[model samples]
Target chain A: MREIQAEEITSVVAEAIKNINFHIRPDVKAELQRALEEEASPLGRQSLQLLLENAQMAAAGVLPLCQDTGTTVIFAEVGQEVRIVGASLEEALQAGVRLATREGRLRHSIAVHPLSRGNSGDNTPAVVHYHPIPGKALKLFVMAKGGGCENASAMAMLPPLASRHGVGDYIVNIIRTNGAAACPPLIIGIGLGGNFETAPLLAKRALLRKIGEFSPDPETAKLEKVLLRRINELGIGPQGWGGSITALSVSIETAPCHIASLPVAVNVECHSHRLTEVKI
Target chain B: MSATWLKLPLEPLVLRDLKVGQWVNLSGSLYTARDAALKQIFDLEADNKQPPVDLKGQLIYFVGPTPPAPGESVGSAGPTTSRRMEHFIPALIEAGVSGIMGKGPLSQSTVKELQRKGIIYLAAAGGAGAFYGSKVRGATITAYEELGPEAIYCMHIENFPAVVAIDLEGGDLFEQGPKTYRKET
Candidate 1:
């Protein structure tokens, strides 16, 4: 059995939060550069150029990539053979989030209540998902999900007979209606064939994948390509001012479901597309 | 097209000259407010009480910036989604606010109100916070300090980049831009 200190988790989470906020993942940066070269609209090209410059400035530590440092979402995959020492996993992760927000100067965006609208000053009680795996190592996936894009996420439980084209239509409609509100040139994550709740979770998880990474399954990969083409064809472009590249990439994660249902969820991510992973 | 350089508290005539897709680099004084600050202003006005800041002829930015790092004027200050403020914007327009800077499209009703009021709506690059923050030369909290980042800040900005998403004549880029560029598939 592998023994891991809880403080190690806290330190790792803290550093990961700080790093992800400061740096745009290289793959996302590359895609933005490509989009900048290909964007036809003058406004779209300008927006992409500014986005690229923002990434550069953020990497230099001038300021964070976004003002919305985002609600910290952590996915922890813990092996059954590993035991956590000292504080519990949840406590450790929350401590790490509080540290990052305070030391890194991230925005404290969490509200204490929905209606009262109270601010959680330190941005605590992170939304964490835990999974038990067979190996001795622990893996952490962290994402700073902006409120604008999170508000745009959707899930539907369709009849089992719903066609794949119908699923594609729903996604297109959501993007069309969202327009510039969700920060276009978005990274789209799709979850298919899961149960009612898991579908959305799968979609959110799919976002943690590196941009441009496709599913190993041939059918799913083809669907990703088709959706990407159709979405860009909508001309939502960068910041939705209009161009040919509405989405940088489309990724899908699928699961087996009961015979009676075809559940799907779409989680839209803004151009910032901030996510990072670490294994310990 | 090259961007037009305009100073804030923009005159109606200057605003009228802006087209839907034109780029702009705005400078001079601007006030920042998002959902919380807007609500407070509305509540105070409803009670017939003095609000914290004067709105007449002022430009409001719908943003909640991150806290500045040491030696910086402000943190990454970027535009938030503007739809959430749609409920409260008409009141601000009635109060003589000249224009709004934000991201995303305004509702049709909001667009009509802006046109009637001769107000302008500008779109800042939404996620380009670091780049925008660098343009802000100074920031001071003007009201609602208790709201933290959501507080109203009077900011001095130089050459802040934006697009005229909605002009004084009710031209809207969000609606028209897509229609012009969309490929018939």
Candidate 2:
């Protein structure tokens, strides 16, 4: 068994939160560069240029890449052979986020209550998902997901007979209608074949994949390509100002499901696309 | 293509000349507000009370900037989705606000109201908050300090860039720009 100290987890989480906010992942940056060259609209191209500059400035520590440093969404895969010392995993992660929010000067965006509309002040209680893996190591994926893009996410439970094209159509329609609001060019994450709740979770998890990387499954990879082409053709352009590069990349993840259902969810991410992974 | 440099508290005539798809580099003073600030303004107006800041002939940016790092004028500040503020826009326009700056498209009814009032809607690059925030020369929270980042801030900006997404004549670049390039595949 591998024993990990809770302070170690806290430090890693804190560093991940702070670093991810200031830095755009290199793969996502490369995609933006490609979009800059390929975009035909003058305004769209200009938007991409500014996005690139923003990434550079953010990395230089001038400011975070986005004002909405985002709701901290963490995915942890803990091995059964690993044991945490001193504190619970959840408390450690929350403490790390709280420290990052203070040290990084990030906005306190979390509302204490959804109805009463109270501010959480420290941006604590990260939305965390945990899965048990077989190895002795623990893996963590963290994303600072902006509210604009989060609000644009959608899901549908289609009839069993709905073809792959129908799924593609639904995804395309959601982007077409809500793409601008989410901030294009977007990174699209799709979850297919899961039940209702898991479908949305899978969709969001799919976004953790590096930009431009395709699923290993051939059929799923092809679907990613097709959907990428279809979404870009929507001409929502960069920042939805209009152009040929609406989406930078499309990633899809799938799981087995009931015989009567085809549940799909689309989670849209903004161009900032701040996410990082750590293993211990 | 070419960006036009303009100063804020833009005149009605100056706003009338802006068309959808035109780039602008704005400078001068403007007020910031988001969902919470807008709601407060609406409530105060409904109660026949005046807001803390004047709305007449001013520009308002829909943004909730991150807290500034030490010695910085502002933190990464960019336009939020404008659709959420649509309901408050007509009221703002009626109060004599000449221009709105945000990201994404506004509702058709909001566009109509903007046209009726001869105001314009500009879109800054979403997710490019760091770049935009750098343009802010000064910022002071003007109202609703309790709302934290959502509070109203009077900001002095220099050469802040945006595109005229909706014009005074009601030309919506969000619709027209896409239609111009969309391939009917």
Candidate 3:
């Protein structure tokens, strides 16, 4: 068995969280560059330019990409052969996150309590998901999910017999109404099948897929293409000022489910897509 | 299209003349308030108490900026989503607010509330915080400092950019701009 120190995980997470807020993912940056060239609206072109510029400035450490640094969501894939020492996984991760929020000067955005509406101040208690994998090394998938885009996320249980068009329509309608606030062009992650809870999880996890990559499933890959075309037609454009190119990409992840259930989820991520993959 | 430069402490006539889809650069002072501060102001008004600052003739910017890095006046200061704060608009207008600047489209009911009232709405680049932060020349906590980023900040800004989203006669670029570009699919 391979043994990994909890401190090592903490250090890795600390840097990963801080790095993502400042640097645009290379794939996302390339997509934005391509979008700038293809965008039909003059206003969209301008907004895209500002977005690219913001990405550059942020990478240089002039400032963060956004004032709303957002909720920390970590998905950890632990190797079956690995054992952790010194601290609990959650404790290690939270300590690293707290350190980054302070040292990086990222915004402390999480609410202390829903009823109180008070700030959490440290931006701790990240939404973490753990999965067991077959490797000897630990993997962490981290995202600084923005509030605006998160507010745009939706989930529904369509009829088990719902057609391809029916499911697509439900996802498109959510973005049609909420896309403006989410910030565009957006990275659309869709989840299909599984139970009610897992559907949204699949969708949220789908966002970590790089822009331009499609589902491994042949049929799901086709749906991603179709959904991208339909959503862009909404004309939400960049910052909702209007134009062609509402979404940058659409990705889907699906799983087998009970025969009676058909669950769907859409996790909308904004132009400022802050995510990274780290192997330890 | 050439951009129009609008000064703060907006005049009623200027507010009426601003048209949807026009790009504008703003200079001078405005108050920054988002979800929490607006709620506080409304609550204060409900009790017939004065808000910490006089809001008359001022434009309210919906933003919650990051705390400044070393030697910076304010940290990344982009606009927040405006629709969430829609509830405070009418009362703020009644309190003499002339304009607002934020991102996203407000709901129809709120748009109707501002109809013929000469209330101008400006939409900034939503998450371009670093860009907007450069435009802020000065900032001071005007009220509710305990609220951190959501605190009301009186900012002296120069040439901050936005597009006029909704104009005096209930003309909204958000409503019209989409239809203009939406392709029949």
Rank candidates, DockQ, best first: 2, 1, 3
Q: In model 3, what is the error at residue B168, expressed in angstroms? A: 1.0
Supply the TM-score for candidate 1: 0.98
DockQ of each: 0.80, 0.83, 0.75
lDDT of 3 by residue, A195-224 (tens): 989999999999989899998889999999
Candidate 2 iRMSD, 1 decimal = 1.0
The order of the candidates by lDDT, greatest first, is 2, 1, 3
* TM of each candidate vs. truth: 0.98, 0.98, 0.98
Listed per candidate, the RMSD to the true structure in angstroms reads 1.2, 1.1, 1.2
Interface RMSD of each: 1.1, 1.0, 1.2
- Summarize candidate 1's per-residue lDDT along A101-204 as a digit string, tens digits: 98889998999998998999999878999999998999999989999999888988888888889989988888888857998899999999889889999999
Give the C-alpha lDDT of model 2.
0.91
Candidates 2 and 3 compared: the better one by lDDT is 2
Q: What C-alpha lDDT, on a 0 to 100 scale, does residue B64 get in candidate 2?
A: 98
Best by the DockQ measure: 2
Candidate 1 local distance difference test against the native: 0.90
Docking quality category of candidate 3 according to DockQ thresholds: medium
TM-score of model 3 vs. true structure? 0.98
lDDT of 2 by residue, B34-131 (tens): 99999989888888788888989999999999999888767989999999999888668767798999999887887887888788899999998889
